[model samples]
Target: MHDERLANLLGAMALAIHDVMLPAVVDSSGVGVSASAALVVLGAHPGLSVSELGRRLGLSQPAAARMVDSLQEQGLVTRRKGTGRVVHVGSTRRGREATRRLLAARSAQLVDVLGSLTARQKQQLEPLLGTLLTALYRQIGDAERVCRLCHRSCCVQDALCPVGQAERSLAGG
Candidate 1:
């Protein structure tokens, strides 16, 4: 059983981030969530197969191919042959620039939201958020999907990234 108050607050926060914040950020970046997500994933992992991308985005191979076609048409992504018949998808320079803009917009929105919290309040919230993220990764079992558009640069550099640590442990590393 979960605490009702906490659950409600979390739900509200999710709504704010998803409905309010994300839409606003996406509007400024001129990229929809799905396309932006694909771009971000491509930026993070430069040479994923279309099938692998489908797995990450919870799309079927055909759907992923359609998405790739759309992105390619938009000059946002490129596809190259890999070993065997695999086609590796990568972001183009234009795609990377779009990703940068998307990330900046998201960061600006989050910064606006976080600006309301006091320094001490933010300090107190950090570990709690990390714990929640760790639990989410465990419950969902998909780190890449769970954090598709995450701009927490710290996660890339920090040894304490809960998702990274969880994934490493789960992989028996």
Candidate 2:
């Protein structure tokens, strides 16, 4: 019974992310899903090294570097000198604006899809989603990768962030 429920939930999440979120953001922002994901991560955690960015995006080092180059060319990101030959990447103002627009569009799409749900149903879904996200973050063990495309504004305050709390618990904090 649990397995069936898990499978169904996973399927729904996959469809919502791949089908609904990606297409809407693409249409509105003219950014591919991967690039937008990268932007979202950078927006959330600035000054990440290229390797870290690549890790978050599940890209190889070379591929990550190339993506950073692309982002730099588009004026969406900037690279700054970090300690001891490390280059840290950060989103430019343009990148932040783009990310904001993409997230807004994504939220609008989600609202449209869930608009029929009663307020009570929406309230009930929040805790369930948080629990699921926390569990998934624990299993994945990589916060940036897991949350690369998440809209930070929707996250419960930092104190209550599921992924953040999951990570802290794992760290024995």
Q: Indicate which candidate wins on lDDT.
A: 2
lDDT of each: 0.84, 0.85
TM-score of each: 0.92, 0.88
Residues 1-173 of candidate 2: C-alpha lDDT, one tens digit per residue: 69999899779977876787788887765667778888999887899999888999999988888888988898999999889968899998898898999999988888887787899999898888789888999888998778887887788654387888889889999
Overlapping backbone residue pairs in candidate 1 total: 0
Residue 165's lDDT in candidate 2: 82
The lDDT, on a scale of 0 to 1, for candidate 2 is 0.85
Q: Model 1 scores what on Cα lDDT?
A: 0.84
In candidate 1, which residue pairs clash?
none
lDDT tens digits, residues 1-173, model 1? 56998899899998877776678657755666877888888888999999999888778999899989989998999999999989999999999898888888888888888999999999898888888988999998998888888764746674477887788888998
| Candidate 1 ranges with C-alpha deviation above 4 Å | 157-159
